[model samples]
Target chain A: MAENYQHIQTAHCENGVVTGLLKHQGLDFMTEPLAFGLGSGLFYIHIPFLKVSGGPAISFRTVPGAIFKRTCKALQIEVVRKKFSNELLAQQFLDEKIAQGIPVGCQVGVFHLSYFPKEYRFHFNAHNIIVYGKENDTYNISDPVMETVTTLTIEELKRVRFAQGVLAPKGHLYYPKSIENFDKKLIQRGIVKGIKRTVNDMLHIPAPIVGISGIRFTANKVKKLRAKLGIKQGGLFLGQIVRMQEEIGTGGGGFRFLYAAFLEEAAEYLQDDRLIPISEQITKAGDLWRSSAVQMAGIYKGRITEQKDFDDAANMLYEIAEVEKTAFKQLEKLKFNS
Target chain B: MEKKDIPQDTSPLKNMTREVYYVKNSDGKYETGLSAGWVVKNEALENAWEDINEQVRAAKQAVLTGEKSPIYYYFVLQLMDYNVLSGYTGFWKFSIKKHMTSKGFKKLSDQKIEIYAKVFNITVDELKNFNH
Candidate 1:
């Protein structure tokens, strides 16, 4: 079952799973950037009331399963997704799929994933992986974040699959059921739809805690963090942002650079030269975010503790918010021939 | 970021797989590149671990002084907060908070203790007897 399976490394897990599964089913055009683009994976939200691992819940991308679901929906591919309430049934279902030689994607927590580095293992439960085959009691895993394929024992897999917490997997497993041959025009249409949705998401969302407004809100809060929460707690807060933006599977710059890469790919696929410049704009935003991360690191590391340093970081984010706002506005105005 | 500019600082991911990143080449085209690690991110991760360890130490001290239960120490050791512990054991957050106290843990039935032990992946005896 694993003979023909090819492991593809990607910057993020969900995008990698979607790209790999589609490529396995004979869709050669499936790339990580294209998958992320068509899935509208770029997003930002800061939920102050929620805490993830003692830090404020800050997300750099859309929700966990949205990429796979949206990418599949846009491509008109039939898929099977299941979440089990019974552990035995979940194991049985996965075993049946593996026996049938069908590679399936499973949502498991990273906290108990034995192959991950101990320091990276937290209570994060949204990690995605592909189980292509089973050899004895071990399952062949293709975690896209890693450089090569890995394995997990049956018990280890079960533990991670049933890891209980916020956004628990509950033995969730998914696979593409039917993949039909699609032409370039279908992809072009998907690109248009994806960009429209992303433009709306980043610009038209009414809530202050999401999209561009979310970036500004977080920046405003960042300016006052030292005064409001004191130095130690505020430094921790900045460190949390840095970790979420750079440490996790964001492809660096909190998915901004990845989105820019997506826009570059989409420009070529759609034969739209206008998108190239907009992609550059987003890249500029990504560069600014990196600078902001560096500034934040200095403050969090105690090398710089002045309020002006904090203001400088906040100002960088404010500029990033403007850059992204303009880029999305341009995308919203551009007409596509679909 | 440029292809050559990607940071390769020492990190916990050392000897493990490098992460994939999107970067620009000299030609200015975006491409996927492998990054060993970055110091900025490493420091953030280390800071987070430090916070966790600090909490664990405090919890251990509390348990040793009979101010809190052993379950509290185990929960902190496992990097779990009250919400996560509640989710795993199917207990209410307030109830779990109460169970963290010495008096509340002393009254726990065997079945309840078994559930906590299972969640922590430790034997009942180990859970019941935590010296350090």
Candidate 2:
């Protein structure tokens, strides 16, 4: 879908030909004229094959911190990489395709670069990156003008001597000011369509079936794919399940403490009703998990004389898988109801 | 001056913040030296000097009681990211910086580092741990 949009968008922007043949392309947008107050920009758009299936394996810099910074950093890396310090934000992404600076399959979005006489401005590949840096008398990419990988620091080097990387608490995400004017366009080009191929091709991504995104898309769309596989997407809440477990007896024993937490979050986007909120789910999953674990213990102990421990564990996991399917189906079905 | 001052770094820097690395010399005492680089300010930084002050104080306390800071010994700790730049809520943490017998040498493991980031609620890049 994203690639199709880009194809037409590129032809329209580049060749100035709004060909009807560009049907699958994504340029058919009609918007109430945006209030272009500070807007001064140009860009061309195109689709690259970086798009991944299994939802293109999107990674969220999940380390935690400001969501904006993580997003900006991604933009920054690409912008500086393209060397388009002169392009307009509107067209920076389009220009990047030509710059051939960044490896192919990487597209610029909303990110552009500004060129100045003394210093090349912008730290990130993106222009108008939210964080600003101070450079010389003029505003440019922030730095001593020389950026060092964190490992080059004395502290970092010291760790390297031991063959281990320094582990520092990631506090925040920020980029130099120079890249600010280097606005990003199509920064989304590959993100929506480019990054998948790049990661898969360059990194030899292990699970091509799933890409880098740990979450699966069938589950993202159909919602009950996990249940269809006869398993829960995440887990079952034990706290809530404890109440029900006593009611369901051995049936509720399959819950795990971690279920509710992942489910609660999963529900926010998936919007399933039977989904337990994260907090209650933890305790609830724990309660249910523990009971099931107890019952499984009896079964295992009884079977231990005849079966290997690994086999028993596998059997237990399978049992848990069954419970997950029931809960996911219930939650999903309830989602439609609500 | 000792390393990494390369002429090939043509990328101009702006808003460079002067930093001092407090290093221990042959005399077994610490001295501050200069290192300048860009200081990127996040309008939405989550951890403030206030939140980490206790840990700093704890480190200082260790220094006072002949127990060096965990940072002094390990330079690593678990972190929780509240995600709110101005103010954080629902954050949690634990200590992970490792202790080495040698002076001025701190090491962190990749796996443990990943966990430290998860605990800190930060990305690996933002951990002041990435090169670019």
Candidate 3:
């Protein structure tokens, strides 16, 4: 019982799933940037005390499922979500949904997904994918991050769905029950609110390890780590930051670029000239952030050894924090007449 | 931070297939294209692999020394920590940690062994023998 599901690869997983599932429900095609923006996905946090997969926690975007949940709310879509305590029951329920011609969104652990490259596979548990159909014992998977539709055995799928870890999926499945049609007015309001929210959080958040302050805090932590951990171990820690930036989802400076892309799209949609320069500003900030990663990587690879070199990398990030601060403040002034 | 400083060595990620990355292009436009394998990315992943391998190696050594059980070795090799293993087997974290020791593993009830086997995707006999 396989439906004709179109597979669209995206830079990030959750937005891609939102775009794909919305399209599958006969809704208008949603661009990745639109989904990301409407979902209010731009965020930053660097919690040094918290550890994830053995490294200090550094997150570029909002938590997983935030975009989907926010975007669905903004779009006025009603969705049905379920989580199964039993693996067999989960599998059976998924089969029934497919038989009923509904494409289901699921959260799974990336570690057990057989199609992922071994180097990319970790114990990360919040990865999203869609199961649109089943043939024999194989489930057709539309993994948003992958280039095309793939197949996984039921046993393999179950293992990934029920993988135990931080943020375990527990066989979670979701599908939209009804999609209400909306026009450009709703999109404009969503964009305005999204930009305002980003500005407020980044500029006004009291937590030192969140928003623009978090970037600066991370820089200070990195400089201190260079002194305490020494070169070899410190380099690994620096590399973990780079990994958090580049390897995870569309991270590294990629989230900044995505946000910038959203601004570009929002500018065209609203015909607002103010957003164009802000988009350009954010793009430059993203570039500086990437430069910081590159410099950190230089230290990580032993190409740069001096403490000054590490300081310079941290300084670049500090500069980006300032750049983002200015750009987002301008975004806060955006007004929608709708 | 310049491009010239990026190390060109790709040996660390030789086992991995090259994948596409959707990144911003030079003109500040988004482009979905294959990444020119950067040494830093490979180094980061290599660091993670090293951590996992280090734990697995230590677990194997402990098992051989009769200090810990073979279940301890497989638990790590399967990429599970004690907390995750506890969640899967419905045991407390302290109890799971205790079961990692040889003496405690030997004292496990048959039902507990079966539960561990199911969670580990192994048969009960395999869980019992746990031949590396």
- Highest-scoring model, TM-score: 1
Q: How well is candidate 3 docked (DockQ)?
A: 0.38
Cα lDDT tens digits, model 1, A192-238, are 99999889889998999999999999999899998988777888898
Query: Clashing residue pairs in candidate 3, if any?
Result: A245-A251, A245-A252
Model 3: runs farther than 4 Å from truth?
Answer: B1-31, B122-132
Candidate 1 accuracy as TM-score: 0.98
Error of 2 at A92 (Å): 27
Which candidate, 1 or 3, has the higher TM-score?
1
lDDT of 1 at B9: 82
**Mind giving the per-residue lDDT tens digits that candidate 3 earns over A84-164?**
999999999999999998889999998878887777777788999999999999999988876668889998999999988
lDDT of 1 by residue, B28-123 (tens): 999988888999888888888888999999999999999999999999899886667987899999889888999999999999999999999999
Stretches off by above 4 angstroms in model 1 are none
How should the candidates be ordered by DockQ, best one leading?
1, 3, 2
Candidate 3's C-alpha lDDT? Answer: 0.79
Error of 1 at B79 (Å): 1.3
Identify the leading candidate in terms of lDDT. 1
CAPRI classification of candidate 1? medium
